[model samples]
Target: MPDASPTLGEAGAASVSPTAVLTIYIPSEAPQDKVTRAIDAILAAHPWEVPVIEVSETRLVMCG
Candidate 1:
């Protein structure tokens, strides 16, 4: 499975930026319903207006 943690990188600023690109990986063994629910939960928790959700067979990328 791919790491679900946020990938930390510098954004060429003097201070460390909080802006992050989160990528969630859902395994093949995981059910589609569960994955959907998880994604929903994450979105609800964050509640970002312009969040980007890119879904593929193996991964989901949520960027704000």
Candidate 2:
């Protein structure tokens, strides 16, 4: 399941703690190269210290 937990950032916090968790999704139908580039750009722009980033159909869940 995707992360349905409430997040501090989403609650309008001024800053996110280093341990805050976030979820992102890329639909399977999306272009692979575009997905790669988009993820790369996100990494370049932010200092996300996530321990793991899984990209598979099993975890391809997203909420509208």
Compute each candidate's TM-score over C-alphas. Answer: 0.50, 0.46
- Give the CA lDDT, 0 to 100, for residue 61 in model 1: 75
What lDDT does candidate 2 reach at residue 59? 58
Model 2 RMSD vs true structure: 11.5
Per-residue lDDT over 1-64 for candidate 2, one digit per residue giving the tens place of the 0 to 100 score = 1333334344333554665455676777888899999878767765534334566664546899
Q: Weakest 10 consecutive residues, lDDT, candidate 1?
A: 1-10
Q: Measured by TM-score, how close is model 2 to the native structure?
A: 0.46
Query: Which candidate number has the best TM-score?
Result: 1
1-64, model 1: which lDDT tens digit per residue? Answer: 1322333433333334365688877788899799889988877866444357788775557999
Clashing pairs counted in every model: 0, 0
- CA deviation > 4 Å runs, candidate 1: 1-18, 58-64
lDDT of every predicted structure (CA atoms): 0.64, 0.60
- Please state the error at residue 9 of candidate 1 in Å: 24
